[model samples]
Target: MSIRKNVLFACLTIIGLLPLSFANAAPDDVFIFSGTRLPTALSEVGSSVSTITAEQIKQKGYRTALDVVEEFAGVTVNQNGGFGGVGSVRIRGALSEQTLVLIDGVPVNDPSSPGGGFDFARIDTSNIAKIEVLKGNQSTLWGSDAIGGVVSITTKIATSPKAIKAYVEAGSFSTYKGGSEISLSNDLGSFRGAFSGMTTNGISKAESGDGNAERDGFDSKTFSGNGLIYLPASAKITAAILYNDSMLEYDGWGAQTGVSDADVTSETEELSGHITLSLPLFKGRLENTFLTGYSETERNYFTSGSKTYDYFGDRLLFRYQGTLNANETNRIAFGAEHEKTTSGRDENSIDSLFILYEIKPMKNATISAAVRVDDHSVFGSETTSRFSAVYRPHNDWKIHGSWAEGFKAPTIFQLSYYFPYSSKVSGNQDLNPETSKSFDVGVERAFLKSRGIIGVTYFRQNTKNQIDYIDGWYENVNKVKSKGIEVAGEYRLSDALGFEVDYSYIDAKKGDGNRQLSVPKNSGSARLIFAPSKVLSAAITMRHNGLEKNTYGNVKSWNRLDINGSYKLSSKLELYGTIENIFDEEYQQVYGYGTPGTSANVGLRLSM
Candidate 1:
C-alpha cells in the first residue's frame, strides 16, 4: 500500500478503538463571544449564531475564511481569480457588502463606501483565533450595514508566558507562503504578535490551449501583523497592521466581450489599534473600549482610471452588566462612532451613537433590543433598531427570533464619480441612505445529549431606496427583497471522526426588475473530518453553487472539492498540506471574472 493510504488506515484504526472513551468524556462548555448584548454563553444568545474555531479551520484545511464559511448554510462567497479582484460574501441572498464585520467588538467595514461593504478577500486567516457569525439583521446593535448579518473575527490572545511558532509552504499556481508568531504572557502583563506573507505567480487551467479569459492569471503579495498587551488591572491594548498588493494580467468575461484588458491591479494598506478597560462598579461591571484605524484602497482596471480612497474612523463604547439574579438579569451598552474619508472629489463623514439592552424575564427566556442614530455628510440623519427573543424548552433544544433595521449612507464616488459613459454625469448630493428591514426565526437542537448540534433558520429582508447609476446619473430604486431558508448541522461520529453540513435556498428580487449581481439562489457545503490519532488529522470538503441567471441573460454554476491533512512530527513540529479545487471545476460566480483552479501546497510548522 502507498504510504499515504497506510497512514490513513492506521489513523482510522486508532479512532475506531476510542469510541467509548470519546463518548464518556466530560461535557464541554460552549461560549458565544459575539452574540447577544455581551460576551455570553451560547445558550444565552437570543438569536441564531454559529462559531468556527481555530481547530476547525486547521482540520478543514481552509486557506481562507471565506472557504470555511461555506460550510454554514445561507453563506456564499463571490471570489475572482487567484489574487485580488472585487471579492465579497453574501448571507441569505443579502448583498456581500451589507454584512457587518467586526474585530474585537469594533466595526471594520469601510464607512467610505455607499454600502460600507468590505471585501472579505483582503483578510488572511493566519492570525484569526475564531469567527462568530450572527445571521439576520443586527442593525439595532451594530448600526448600518448590519442589515443582512454580522461576521466577527477575534484574533488570538496568548495566555502562555512565552511561545513561538513558524510555518512555510509552497502550493499550486507557483504560490509560496511563510509566517512566524511570538507571544509572551505572565501575571503582570501579556503580549502577542504574528507576521505572515504569501506570493503567487500563475495558475494551471482545467481547459488549456486557448487564450480564454479564464486563462488570464495573477500575482499577489500580502504582509500582516497584530499585537496585544494586557495590564494587571484588567486593562488591555491592541495594535494591528495589514498590507496587500495584487496584480492581474489576464482576460475573463471582460476580455471575451470586447472589453479586453491585460493588466489590472489592486493595492490596499490598513492599520488599526484599540484599548479597553473593565472594572467593578456599583453592584455591576463597568467596561469601556476605544478603537481607531485608517485604510487606503486603490484599484486600476487598465481602462478605468485608477480609483483611490482613504478612510479614518474611531469608536468608543461603555457598558454595565448586572450579575445574574432571580427575576433580575440586565446588561446595557452604549457607544459612539465616527468616520471620515478623503480623496480627489470625494470627501465625506459620519457620526453616530448606539445602545443595546438585554433582559431576562424568566429562567429560560430572554429579550434584547438596540437602537442607533447617525448623521451623514450628505444623507443627513438615519436611525436603526432591533428586538429579539430566546426560549429554551429543553436542555438540548432552543428557539430564537429577531427583527432588525439598518441604513447605509451614500459614498463620495457613488454620488460624484463621473466618466464619459456616453454622456456627462453629476453627483446626486441629495441621495438618501438605503433603508432595510429584516427578521429571522430559528431553532437549535443538540442531539446525543448535546454531542451534536442541528439548526434551521428562516430569514427575510426588504431594502428600499437602493442607489444605482442610470445613464450617467444616479437614482434610487424603490424596493428589493431577499428571503431564504438555511439548514446546518455538526455531528461527532466518533472521537476522531466528525462531519458538518450547510444548505441554503434564497429567493431574491428587485422591485425594478434588475438582478442583483453575484447573488446565488442556492448554495451549500459539506465537510468530513478524521482525526486518527492525537498527531494526525485529515478533511474532505465539497462545495456547491447553483446556477445564476444574470440580467444580461447569462447563466453560470460551479462546484469544487478540496482536501486537507496535517501530521505532527513531534510535540513541537508539524506538517500540513492543502489541495484546493481537487476536481478542477472551471466556473465563475461573477459574470466576468477568472476563478482559481486545482492547486496544492505543503508546508512545515514548528513551535517552541
Candidate 2:
C-alpha cells in the first residue's frame, strides 16, 4: 500500500474505534517541572509537552527509554541496528544534536562527539520514575543545545514506607533480562536503589545478505540510587547517582567490500551524579535551591580483540535558582548557571542567567514570558526569549500559543579537531552558533462528558547558521525551514477498554528547497488497551513510519505490531509477557542496518 493510503487507513481506523462514550478523564491537577523549571499544572502550561509515568512504562513492557519516547507525537528515533547500537532522536525535523537531554536535571550529552548528542541506547527503563518531553525551542529556560527541545528523565524515589520489587525475563536470541529495586522511608528521609542488567546474542549489524551471517552480541548493566533528607527550618537535601557499562559487537565497513560483516566491538562506561539543597524563607513565600552535578563517559573500540581507538568526555555544573510568590496572581523564577565541559585536552565553559515571569491576568487566562543570556568562552554571548499564553474559554475547551528563540554553540570536537594528513578536512575555529525561531498554536477539547480529550497543533520553525560538513570542512552554511501538524487523542470506550492515538505530518526543507534526509513526512502510532478484570490486562500497539530518503537510497515505509499482557497471580506476584514484530516483518531503519524479526519474552514480577 502507498504511504498516503496507510495514513488514511490508520486515521479512519482510530476514528471508527472511538465510541461516543469515553472512559476516565486525565487528572487536571497533574504537575510537570520541565515546562517552566517550576511545578506547574499541566492544564496551565502553554507548551507542547508529553509525559510518561512508571506505570505506563511497566504496562507497555518498554525495555528502554527510547522505546517509550518514540511513541510520542513530533518525535522520531533511528538506530543503526538493534540493542546497544548508536541511537539518535530528532524533534520536528531538528538535528539530533540540537535536542537537549537530562538525567536528574543534569546535562549528559557526550562532549567528545562531533555533535554532542545523547545516545538513547544507554538509558534503561528499569530505574526511571517519569519522563517529560517539551517540544520546540527551549533555550529561554535551558541554555544552548535546546534548539530542538528538552527531555528530562527522573529516577525512581521512595513512594512508601518500605517496598521491594524485582523482575526476570528470558527470550529469543539467547536474551536474558532482570532488575530489582528497594526503597525505604522514615520521618527524616527516604531512599531508593535499583540495579538492572541484560545480555543478548543479537543478529548481524550489516544487512543479512552477501555472506553476512555472523551473529553480533550485546551486554549491559546499570545501577542507580536516590536519597532525600529533611532538615531543620523548612530545609531539605537530595542526592542521586547512576552508573552504566556496556559492550557491543558490530560490523565494520571497507572500501573494497562496502559494509561487509567484520569482527569489531566497542565498550562504553558512564557515570553521573548530582546533589541539591533546598531552603524556604519568608514563611514559604520565597524558595531557593543550590545544585552541583558531574558526569563522565569513556568509550573504547576494538578490532580483532585489539584496542584501536578511545575517547573520554566529562562535564561539571553548578546552579542556583530562586522562586518568589509575588502575589496571589503572579510568580517569578530566576536562576544562574555555570557549566564546564572537557573533551580530552580541549575544554570550555559557559555562564548563563535566566528569568521567567507568569501572571494570571484573568480568571481564565495565563501569560508567561522568559529571557536568557549565555556567555560562551569561545563564541562570546547570545540571548534568547520566549512568550506563551493559555486561555480557557469554557470548562472543557482550551487554547494555547507560544513563540520562542533558541541557539546552539559549536562542540569542542567540532571547533578544535584537526586533520594533519588532509588540508581540506579540519574544524573551523571561527564558526558561529546556530540560531532558530519557532511558533506554535494548539487547541484542545474534552468530549463525552470529559471522559475523552483531543488536541491538534500547528508549528513552524526556521533555523540559520546551522553547522555542517561542507567541502570536507566544518562550516555554518546550512539553513533549514520546517513546518508540521500534530494530532493526539485519548478515549475510554468502556470500563474495560481504552484507546490512544497520535499522528505527525512534517515538511522540512533546506535552503535549496531539497527535502531533509532521513526524515519521514508521515508517522504515527495507535494502541488499544483492554482490562476486563482487576487481575488481568492486555494491550495491542501499532506503529507506522513513512518512506525516507538516505544518502544511498530511499528507505521503504513499514508497519509493526506489538502485544503485551499481564496477569496478577497474587497480591505481590505477577506474570507478564510481550511479543514484538508479530508479523515477522523484514525491515531496516537505516540503509544497511538489520532489524529484529519476530520475538517474544515472558517474565515474572514480585513486589512486597
Candidate 3:
C-alpha cells in the first residue's frame, strides 16, 4: 500500500481496538460571551448568529477557520483554486466589502484589497477559541463595512498556571503542518505564546482541460502573543499582537486569465496589535475600558522573480468604552472612537460617537436601542440607528427581531487608485457612502429534554447609493434589495448518534433590473456524527451550492461530501484523519478555476 494509505489504515486500526461507552450528556445552558465590546448570551442577540465553538472545531478535525464558517446558514464561499488561494465569502446576498471581520476586538480588513475584504483563506484555526458569526446589517456597534454582518474571532489565552501543547500533520500533495502553544497564568499575571506554519504543493489554478498541469502552491506562517497584568484595584492591563506572512501562486491578475504554467507570485504580510486598560468603579456596577490599536497590511507582486507591484495599507484606532448597570433590569453602554487610514498618497480619517441602552421590560423580554453619528473627512457626517427586542414566551421558545441602519464608506482603492494608475476605469473621488436599512425576525425552541434545537429566521434589507461599475466608470447608480430565509435544526438522537441540517433561500435584485452576480438563490448543508466508542468519533458532512451566474456565464449547482474522524489514544495524545471531497466532486465556485479533488490527511496532537 502507498505510504499515505498506510497512515490512514493505522489510525483506523487503533480506534477499532478501543472500548465503547454508552452514556451521553448535554449542557443545560450554552453561553456566548456578552457585553458591549465582548460577547453576550445567545438569547439576547436579535440578529442571526452562527457560532462554532472550539470543541466543535477539534471534534470535526477542521484545519482552517473558513472550514467551520462554511457550514453556517446564509453563508457561501467562493474560491479561485484550492487551499491558500484567494477565497471570498458572501453573507445574506451582501457584497464582499460589506462584511466586517474582527480578531479580538480589532479590525483586520485590508484597504489595499480590491474591495476591502479579508481573504478567509489566510486565517489559520490553530489557536482560535471560538468564531462568532453575526449575520444581518449590524452597524450600531461596529461602524462602517458592517452592512452585511460581523465575524468575530477570539483566540485562546492563558488560563491555566502553566501548560504546553503541540501538533504536526502531513498529507497528500507534499503538504506538511506544525504548531506549538504555551501558556502561564497566576494571581499576579498571565502570558500566552503560539506559533503555526503550513505549506503545500497545491493543485493548479486553471481547470483540468487545455493541457493545464502546472500546480499553484502556498506557504503561511503566523505568530501571536497575549499578556495580562493584574492591578492593585479591580482592574488589569491587557495587550496582544498577531502577525502573519503568506506566499502563494496564482495564474494572472488585472485583465487576463490565469496561465497553467507560471511563476507569478504574491507575498502578503499583516500585523495587528492592541493594548487596553480595564477598570471597575462604584463597586463593579460601572465598567470602563480604554483601548488603542494599530493594524497594517502589505503585499508585493512578482513576475519571474522580479517585483512588479507593491502596496501597503495602515489604520490606527482609539476608543473609550464604558458600560453602566443602572439596575438589575437596565444597562447602558457608550463609546467614542477615532480612526485614521492611509494608503499610498491618499489619507482619510473619521471620528464617531455611539450609545446603546438595554432594558428588560418583562422577566423574559429584553429590548435595546442604539444610535451612532460619524464625521468623516470626506463625507461630512451621517447618523445611524438600531432597535431590537427578544422575548421568551416560555422556557421552550425564544423570539427575536431587529431593525437596523448600516453604511459602507468608500475605500482608498475605490476612491483614489485611479489617480496613480489611470486606465479606462479610473477612480472617482466624488463617490458617496452606501447606506442600508434592514429588518429581521426569528424564533427558536429547544425540545426532547433540551437535547435538540430548531429555529427559523426571515430577513430583508434595502441599500441605496451603492457604488458599482456603470458604463466604465465608478458611480453610485445601483439600489439593491435583498431578502432571505434560514431554517436550521440540531438533534442529538441518542447517546451514540447526532445530526444537524441548515438551509437558506435568497432572492436578491438590483433596482436597475438584474440579479446579483454570483449570489446563489438556494443552498443547504447537513451533518451526521457517530460516537460508537468512548475513544473514537466520526462525522460526515454534505453541502449543496445552488446555481448562480458569474462573469463567464451561468454555472450549475454542485454537491460535496466530506468525512472526518478522531481517536484519543491517551490523556495527552490523540490521532485524527480527514477525507475532503469524498465523492471526488469536480466543480468550481468561480469561473476558470480548479477545485480540489479528493484528498486525505492524518495528524497527531499532544498536550501537557
Q: Could you arrange the candidates by lDDT from highest to lowest?
A: 2, 3, 1
Per-residue lDDT for 368-407 in model 1, tens only? Answer: 8888887777777888887888899988889989888878
- On a 0 to 100 scale, what is the lDDT of residue 398 in model 3? 94
Q: Model 2: residues >4 Å from true position, as ranges?
A: 1-30, 254-258, 420-422
Q: Rate the local accuracy (lDDT) of all candidates.
A: 0.67, 0.86, 0.81
Q: Please, what are the lDDT tens digits per residue for candidate 3 over residues 1-608?
A: 13223422432333233223212222114354422343357777666788887888887778887787888888877887876888777888888778888887778888787568888887888878889887877777788888888888887777666779999999888889999998766665666789999999998887665456888899999987776666777697777777789999887642323335567899999877677788989998888998877777889999989999988887778988888889988988899999888887787888999999988898898888999998888888989998888999998899999889998888888887664443554678788899999998999999998889999999998999888765556778569999999988999999889999999998888886787877899999899998988889999999899998776666579999999999999989989999999989988887677788899999998889
Model 3: ten consecutive residues of lowest lDDT: 19-28
Candidate scoring better on lDDT of 1 and 3: 3
lDDT of 1 at 436: 89
Q: For model 1, where is the 10-residue window of minimal lDDT?
A: 19-28
Q: Cα RMSD (Å) between model 3 and the true structure?
A: 8.7
Error (Å) of candidate 2 at residue 507 is: 0.9
